[model samples]
Target: MNTSASDPVTDAPTKAAPIIEAQGIDKLYESFQALYDIDLQVMDGEFVALVGPSGCGKTSLLKILAGFEQPSRGSLEIQGKSVVGLPPSQRPTRMVFQKLALFPHKTVRDNIAFPLKLAQVSRAEQDARVAEMMDLMHLPSAYATRYPAQLSGGEQQRVALARSMVSRPSVLLLDEPLSALDVKLKKVLQTEIKHLHRTIGTSFVHVTHDLEEAMMLADRICVMRHGRILQNGSPTDIYYRPADAFIAGFIGETNLIPVQMDGAAFDNPALRCADPTLDEAQFSPGHAGTSGLLMIRPELIVMRTEAPDAAEVDCVMEGSVEEFFIKGSSIQYRIAVEGLREPMIVDVQGTATPPATVAQKVWLSFQRRDLYLLGEG
Candidate 1:
């Protein structure tokens, strides 16, 4: 289910209390406001991703959470205790930066043990903990004596993670830690990070602009825009049931067909629904008697040589293929429908033979239940 006004999405039967909570948080840099009334909660062991375009205040929010920047106006809590002005060192959190900020001159072991040494932990305990972290991060024992420059990018990332995690903080804040890596390494580290979170059971609050990364790594995603959160929910909810047109167009390519809402049905001559009588529930909330967009994902649209069985599908439209793209796993087709201004996108699984050629007349059909109504706003 979609969350309401920044409320945390509760997907489990037994909910865990939040390990980090920010209520009505706002931030300002002199005359420019950077964040709005933001409410967020990270449950124990939950992975939450703050995602948006650059300059959307996600990093500002992350800094606030990490105690690097104080919220201009708001209440901040950690594990049920107020911590608005607490310093980063005093807070029960650690941050892994995008640059993987490992000390160039220090060996891996010394880097991992730095926090413990700062806390005046005994030499024996420091050694034990650093050794344990090295093993946990899958770093070789031999690499402990090597400097940051001696390790590969992925290995250096592991060292940075180990350093942040060695102190056993309650929450781990990641600020685009995987953004600099190549695609293959990013995917490998993504899996490793997910596995590490599951293994350690620590709360992770990751900030990133990559929607695909957020969807893959996070238990819940908060999509932000222009210093405010637009929607926050599970990946499936955000993908299929976006709040508005901007959000529907954010994550991936989608077809948004304009239609006027007439009571319980869409009043568009160009569109056809299998069920003439549509329930009010089929429409988006607060959009009756007004213009709206019908959202259809590219992969959900089916291409047919002949007319589809009207009883089996809810919506059907005839269009001619204007362009086609050969994606490795799927073929993407741009079809020009008479009533729509832009070409409709459809993704079909790759096959030995193409489904339809350019300029070929094709019928696009999709089920009603798969469709979502979205407001233009």
Candidate 2:
């Protein structure tokens, strides 16, 4: 719950020791390259998430860091020590895979105690640690005797987390750990994972395709694409100021309109704004004829009836409501503007009052600052 905006570890002048570091990491599978010079760093006790599509090499990079596979080029260091040749067990890292990997016959207590037994901890010590881990994971003491088959999917995941943490490794790598659980169970486990990180104070490198999960739990998110890091920042940063079109569209719902920057305004007679100087930052002096993308979030745009006689600062665009969908807490509208090729999506909270029907004439408007500029298609 230490939610200060400024970083607490590094006082000022000096940089803090990174819990995990990977530089110029490369992985190749004969002809195709799975990873290419991927560089990343995780601070002590930070929860960092790696997110991307299926073939984005997220798993390969994580495996490389875990010592499951050595990188073809580059280096990896954990807790300031080079672990290139070290075995997974020797490195101060524990990985919890998608499959909880719990032994079906073993009881919860026995499962959590497995790591301790492998390390040759005394019987009494192992029992004590197992009890502590179960308590930390909020599992009932009576459930310790029950087998994995008797536990729910979430319970199994908790057991996996407990097992991984039993050794008190400096870093924990979670690879899509909640993908198998149902929606409700996934949401619950997400919170549990966040809480677990707070209590344990271990650096967590979580890999997932779920953007919302990454946004909610991660202190920083590293967005990957085609085996490379595209953008790395906090959730707010990624959502508000996406570094590229790929990230802007991937992290959340966005309408990337193809437009040209003419002077300070986005040109398209149909989508012209009140203030022509609105999107001036999108264009450079020498880049006049270049095409650019206007990144607009659905939530930032509002639907208004009749023209307002207010200041000449607001940007307005005319579009006809093509269709609408009722989400739990909001309504989504798909509107087709006059000149735009694709329909613009607008999201409004609490079921847009007197919602528009199909082919209804409507005006979509948004502020200047809300628009983000990105490279053209």
Candidate 3:
């Protein structure tokens, strides 16, 4: 478990001092509880995305981190200093909101300089810092005189980010800053934000409901539910080894077929789980009868007109292509395999030749090693 920047893979935490730490954090609004006992640690220069359904406490946590709202209980620290009672202005953090919140009347330079001014930095220093931040955002120097109303959405977004970065805060908090943009623009900024994070190397705690956005930007992901932290780990861990069926369904597209113990091995009537990778070690007594899901990613299944020998493939099932739609570079298939109530999705490259058409028989073969057994669906 490497916890330092020198490690090639940071699937585990880094050894650096946490840039932000929360212990036993809770939030309550009179009789209503907005957060449960939450403990989190964000390492210096790491990008952590807080994601969940609406009203799931992601935003509440971010607000607490920025000092806009105090936690109902527990302690928080930034740079190892307790900030339980600190005001937003006094904290070593900055928040960029979905609305961008650039001053309508202020020019780009002034908007970016406002935070430095509040800190009472010298005018010369403020100008130098703003110029440096603008360069980091790749905003042209010529745009300094333009107001928010004159710049495009991407430009305004960069300006808002510039303002946040100019302060050189220990951590940056984002509240769905790109949620309002069109899909194309949102994707473009997602890449830019991730790139900027690497260039600036600041701890970013982004709050969003968009799973793709979280996957695109974060070094680590914290999944929340009902005001509680449900899971936290690397993207691969979260996707390939989800803690539960709900997490699997929410994180990406997949076919979660019900499975049960058929004698010593797990079995799904609709699909087969005969891969050698699975055995007694993978099952528990409680899951003997029927309480698991055979998680198969669409991309993991190979579509074939002729079935492979059972001994050669992990799991094999016959199905007919009931429907399909072009999805960018891949074709998404809705296959009605034997015994499954709902159709399963099989994703294949768009260039697949002699493609399977509606009502066409096809074989869905997936490696047993690729099958993930999820507990009690």
The prediction achieving the highest lDDT against the true structure is 1
lDDT against the true structure, each candidate: 0.89, 0.86, 0.86
Per-model TM values vs. the true structure: 0.92, 0.92, 0.91
Which candidate number would show the highest TM-score if scored against the true structure?
A: 1
Candidate 2's residue-wise lDDT over 190-260, tens digit each? 99899999998999999998999999999999999999998889998888778888888899989987777
In candidate 3, what are the lDDT values of residues 169-275, reduced to their tens digit? 88999999999888988888888899889988999999988998888899999999999998999987777777777788889898887777555456666676465
Indicate the TM-score of model 3: 0.91
| Positional deviation of residue 275's Cα in model 1 after best superposition, in angstroms | 1.0
Candidate 3 residue runs with Cα over 4 Å from true position:
1-14, 262-264, 273-290, 352-354
| Better-scoring candidate (TM-score), 1 or 3 | 1
Candidate 2: stretches off by over 4 Å: 1-13, 278-289, 310-313, 352-354
lDDT of 1: 0.89
Clashing pairs in 3: 3-13, 3-14, 3-15
Instruction: Tally clashes: model 2.
Output: 0
